[model samples]
Target: MKSKILLNLSLFALLISSLGTSLHAQTYGKNGMVVSDHHLSSEVGVSILKKGGNAIDAAVATALSLAVTHPEAGNIGGGGFIVFMKADGDVTTFDFREKAPLAASPTMFLDENGEIRDNSNHKGLLSVGVPGTVAGLYQAHQKYGKLPWGELVQPAIDQAKNGFPMSFGLYRAALQVSKRDSSYDILQNFFRGPDGEVVAPGELWKQPALAQTLEAIRDQGRDGFYKGAVAEEIERYMKANGGIITQEDLAKYEAVERKPVKTTFKDFEIFSMPPPSSGGVALIEIMNLMEEADISKIEFNSTAYVHLVAEAMRRAFADRAEFLGDPDFNPEMPIDHLISKDFAKSRFENLDLTQASKSDSSKFGQLYGGDHTTHFSVIDKDGNAISLTYTLENSYGAGMGSDKLGFIFNNEMGDFNPVPGITTSTGQIGSDPNLVAPEKRMLSSMTPTIVAKDHKPYLVIGSPGGRTIINTVFQTVLNVLAYDMRIDRAIEAMKIHHQWLPDRILYERNLLSPDTRDALEAMGHTLIPTTNIGVLMGITYDARLRAYVGAADSASEDGAAKGY
Candidate 1:
C-alpha cells in the first residue's frame, strides 16, 4: 500500500510539473483522478485515492486539512455549504452556514446615531455566528464517506499539530488580511509577533489551540466542537471582547438541509444549493435566459457574445437583489416563480442587446450580498461529486481571534441588514429577514457548482470573491461548455465579471481584447480593468475518457489551484 501510494503521489507530482512547465502565465494543474483548490491539497486527495479511499473520504480529509495548509483563507472554525452528487445520481445539500446569536436582534448593529456601524456588525462578539462547519463535515461523511471519520480528520490534525511550511499563496494572502473595521482587543494579541507586528507569511505558524480543538473533535465527534469546551471558548472570547455570542446560540445551531435547486442546462442536469444563496437561483435565471439565445453562432468572446451574457447577468443580478433570500424567512423568494420559463422570459425579454441596462434593472443589482464565501469541489472515483463553499464574511473573519483555538471567528452577521427594514415578507419593518437572529444563517455569495453534459457530470467549478463569484464561475463554465477548452486551457483562461451595482463590467486586465471592452462601453456598460480578476479553482471532466482534468487560476498570483 505504501509503495503504491508513493508511486501515485510521484506520478501526480510529475504530471503537475509537466503541465506547469509550459505556463509562464502562472497557472497550475495535474491530470489525475482527483483535483482540489490547491495542487498540494489535490495531491493529498490523490494519496487518499491511492490508499483505497473514495473522493468523499479524500475530500473530507482535504477540506479539513485546508485549515492548516490554506489557513489564510479558511479553517475548521468557519462555516459553509456543501452539495454532494453521488455516482448513483443522488444529491444532498448541507447548509452549515453560521447562525446568528440568540441575543441578536434586527437592530443589533444600529448605533446611537441609528446608522449601521461596521465595527458593531463586523467584529467582537456580535459578529460571531453559531458555526456549523463541524456538523456539516460530519453530515457529509456520515452519508457519503468511506473512510473512518477519525482517520479522515487525522490529516488536518497532523498538519495543525506539526506545522506545514507556508506556501507563497499564504505569504501573499497574508498581505491582504483585513483587520476588523475597528481592531478587536483580542485581535491585537492574536496576530501580533515578537516585535508587535502582524505575523508575516513564511513564518512557521501552528495553531496549538486549533490543533487541540481538532483533537477534541476527533475524540468526541461533533459534540466536541459545537456543544462542548470549544463552544465555551468561543462564547467566552465573544464576551471578553464585547461581542454577543453565547452558549445557547452555539447549542441551538443546526446545519440545514435544503433541496438542491435542479435545472436543465444544455445536455446536463444541474443541482445547486438554493437560496439564502442567490448563486443557484441567479445562475438558473441566467441560464434560462441565455439558453433562449443562440450565443455559439455569434462567436466565443466576441463583442456580441460578451454583450448578451453580460446583459443576462445584469438582469439576473437585478432580480436576485429584489427577490432572493433565506426561503424560510422570506416567503416570496420567487425562486421557482422567477426561474419558471414564462417568468424568466418576461424578465429576459426586458433585456436589450443594443444597450446595457441600468444597475437598477438586474436581479443581483445589489448582490454584494456576501463576501465571506469560498469553494471546493470533489468527486469520488465512484462518480459521486460534492461542491462545497465556506466563508467567514471577509478576510480573517471578524479579525477577532480565539487564538487558543488557532482560528479566527467570523463576522458573518455583517451579511445581515442593520435595521428593521421593509421586505415583501412580513410586509413590515423588521429584521430584513436576514438581520442577525438567534440560529438564523447569514446570506452568502459563494457559488460552488458542477455541470453535467449529456446526462453525465462534466465540470466542477467555483470561485472565491464577493459578487465576483457569479461572473467568475459563469465565464469559466462557458469557456468549457460553450468553447470546449481542455481543463487546463479552460481554467487558465482569463476571467470577466459584471455586477448589477456600480454599473461597471470589471475586466481582468490584458486578458480580453480591446474590442471587447470597447463593445461593452459602446453599449453604455461601464468597464473597469482590475489587477487580478479573482482566483478560481475548477476541475473539468471528460466523460468518455473517464478521467479528470483540472486547473487553478494564476490570474491572482494565488498558487492554490496548482495541483501537486
Candidate 2:
C-alpha cells in the first residue's frame, strides 16, 4: 500500500508538471489579449487595446495589420465573418462575405459541352469576387468602435510603407507563388528583389502601392477603397485582365449585420456567425449530436471518442452541403431543425459504436473551399470579445495580384458550385443552395465563435481550415467545455476531420496511437494522414487568475499571442 501511494503521488506530480509546461506556452493578460496568425498583427492589436480601444477596435487593427504582414490569407481584397459579444451578452455578427459579380451565372464556369473550362472558377480574373473586407470592417467600427478609424488604419499603413522583417513562412509562400506560371508575373515581381530573388527571411519587405491604398482608406474610410482612386485602379486592372468586377460592384457592396446563431451546451452559451457561413449551423449541429453522448466517460483521443466525433461531423457536413447557403438567398433553409437537439438525436438513432458510418456522396454535397484563411480573437478590459475570420479562398488567392494595387484578389467565386448536378467523389458539390448567382455571397466554413459561461465571455476562438474549420472549432470547444482542458492544451491538441464525402477521416500526423489506428481500421474506417489540421487563435478567461489566457496554434510558425 505504501509503494502504491508513492507511485500515485509521482504520477500526480508528473501530471502537474506537464500542465505547467502547457500553461507556460500561453500569454496572460488582465486587461486585454489578442491572438493572431502573425506576431506583428497580434502586437498591433495589443497596442490598440493599450491605447484604450475596445475589442472591436483591436480586431479591426489586427485584421488590417495582417493584410500587410500575413498576405497569404488576410486582405482588403477578401471578405469574411465576425462574431461579437458585448459585456452585457448582447451578440451580433457581421457578414462581409464576398459576393458573386453581377455578371456571374450558375453555369458560367462550364464550357460549351457543360464541362468545366480550364478550371476557370478557381483561376485567373473571373474567379475574383467583389471584395467585402473593407466594408465589413468599416460597418463594424461605425457601430461599435470607440477609437478613430484612422488610428486603427495607421499601423497597417506604416507596416506597408516602412516595411517589416520578412518571416520564413512569408518568404516560403512568396517563393512558391513566384514559381507559378507567367500569369502570376505581377505577384512574382512584387516579392522579388532587385537581384530578382524571392525576399529572404529577416529581410525588409515593403509595399508602397499598398501603403498608398491604405492611406486612401485611412483618409476616406470605406470610400477610400470602394469609391475613388483605388476603385478606379481595380476596375482598370480588371478590364485589362478579363475580370468582371467593376466600379459599380465595388460601390454597391455593403456588409450586412446578421443576428448571430446562438445555442446552448450544458452550462455554456455559444454564439457564431449565421448562414452565408455554414460554420455556425454546422458547428451547432455537431455539438448537439455530441451533447447526446456522455463524452466525459470516454478517454480523450481514444478510438471511440474520435469515431464518435467523426460521425457527428459527417452528419453535420452532410446537412451543410445539402441545405445551408447565404440566408439572403436561401431563406427557407431548415436551420432550426438542423440545430435542434431532437434532430441530432434522430440523425444518430442507429447505434454503431463498433463501426464507422459510411459517407455517401450521392446523398450529400462535397466541400470545395480552400484552406488558406486567417482567424483572430480579441478580448478587452471591458469584457467585450470578438472572433473574426477572413479568407482569400486559396493561398495567395489566384496566385496573382494587381501590380497597381499590390494586393491579392480572392478566388472566392470558386467556392460556389462550378456546375449544377455535378457532385464529384473528389470533393465537389453542386447543391442548388450554393449555385452562383449575381450578387450572392458564396457559402463558407469560416466559423468564428465565442462561448460564454454565467453570462460572461469565457472563450473566444476560431480557425482557418476551409471545410475543416467547423470540426476544428468543435473539437477545441469540446476540449475546454467538455473535457476541462487548459486553453493552451485545447489549442495544441491534435484534430481530425470528416467532411461527409470521400468517406475518409483526415487525422493529423501521429494523432492516433498505433493501437488506436489499428482498432479504428478494424472498425472499417479509412483514415488518411495530413501534415496539419488548422491554425487556431484562441483566448480563454481564467476566472481564478482573473486574466485572459491566449494561445496561438503551434502549427503556425509565425503565430503569436499578445496581451497587456
The candidate maximizing lDDT is 2
RMSD of 2: 8.7
Model 1 segments beyond 4 Å from truth? Answer: 1-33, 175-203, 361-364, 369-372, 420-433, 556-564
Which pairs in model 2 have colliding backbones? none
lDDT of 1 by residue, 366-434 (tens): 533345355666665566676777776676676666767777777777766555543322111223545
User: Going through the candidates in order, what is the number of backbone clashes in each?
Assistant: 20, 0
lDDT of model 1, residue 34:
44
TM-score to native of every candidate shown:
0.87, 0.95
lDDT of 2 by residue, 1-564 (tens): 999887656645533332223423699999999999888889899999999999999999999999999988999999999999998989999999999989989989998999989989999989999999999999999999999999999999999998777766677778787778888646767787667887676566788889989999999999999999999999999898889999999999999999988789989999998999999999998888778876778899998998999888888888899998888989899988988888978988863878888877676856788999999999999999999999998887876667778888999999898889878777788889999999999999999999999988999999998888999999999999999998888988989999988888999987678898889899988889999999899999999999999998887777888888
Give me candidate 1's TM-score against the actual structure.
0.87
Model 2 misplacement above 4 A:
1-24
